[model samples]
Target: MLKEFYPYEYARNVFAIDYKKLAQMGYTGLIFDVDNTLVHHGDDSTPKVDSFFAWLHKLGFKTILLSDNEKSRVERFNKNIRTQYICDAGKPDPKGFLKAVELLGEPKDKVVCIGDQIVTDIKGANNAGLASILVHFIRLPGEKHIGKRRYIEYFVMWTWKHRRKYRHRLGDILRSGK
Candidate 1:
């Protein structure tokens, strides 16, 4: 059951994701988590992020931000990035993922969900029948409450890294869950 939280893949950060490869692999849409996935918690978009989104557009991938934050926060953060978004989205819920796919007007099999959290992002994408990519958070989290959740995620990630049949192909860096 814990395997349900495992991501289809992991990357060092959002910038590390290969958009070309994703497009080539037939993923036409991307659903992203805004917080730690795209930027530091509660921070606005960076120039790098802006460029990345532009690149995604150029590469023919429709993008959307699906965040658990309030509309104000999501709107404020998206001002510079300028992607379609749904705020206060309940993650780990199939509804949000389905809604994101609907917003993109794409089939579920052609969409990929990207985020930093396993409990929400990976689980939700898996449940919604979308491919999921887990990326390391841009910065250390400020909240103390997330530490325990992080610990739990580490255990599950460890299982995937050490025991899964595909672990050998993931290499040490990603398996380390740095």
Candidate 2:
């Protein structure tokens, strides 16, 4: 069960990922979690985010925003980025991930889901048999309390980092052609 929370890859941030390498790996689609994963929770897209999406499109990758947040929240964040989105996605459930794959018109193996939360984003991708990249969540200002789940996530991430067997790097995968 704990293994389900393990992501296929981990990155410091979305901008830190090598999309070109992923495209070379035959990954044609990307499903993203908007809040924290892309920007701080409830924050609007920045020029950096806009440019990133444009660069992704140029690399021939189809993208989608999949979030558990309400439609309006997702819509507001996606307004300038302009990607297809599924709001109120009920993630950690395979349904939303599978739906994103269908919407991307790509095979499950050809799609990768990127997000900050392990339980929701990584587990959902694992459950749906798609690849996943886990990014560290962006911390919001004045955010002192993170709740119980975050503590558990921290422990999980600690284990994932310290245990060599559990660590998977995207660069390593790309180099091995796996």
The reply for model 1, stretches above 4 Å from the true place, is 140-146, 166-178
Model 2 lDDT tens row, 26-145: 889999999999999898989989889989999999999999999999989888889899999999999999999999999888898999999899999889988889888888778897
**Ten consecutive residues with minimal summed lDDT in candidate 1?**
168-177
| lDDT per model vs. reference | 0.83, 0.87
Top-scoring candidate (TM-score): 2
Per residue, candidate 1 scores C-alpha lDDT tens digits across 1-178 of 7767888777888876667767777779999999989888898888888988988999999999999999999999888778899988898898999999999999888888889999999899889888888887666646445567788877888888775653423223232332
Q: List the residue pairs that clash in candidate 1.
A: none
Give candidate 1's root-mean-square deviation (CA, Å).
3.5
TM-score quality measure for candidate 1: 0.88
Clashing pairs in 2: none
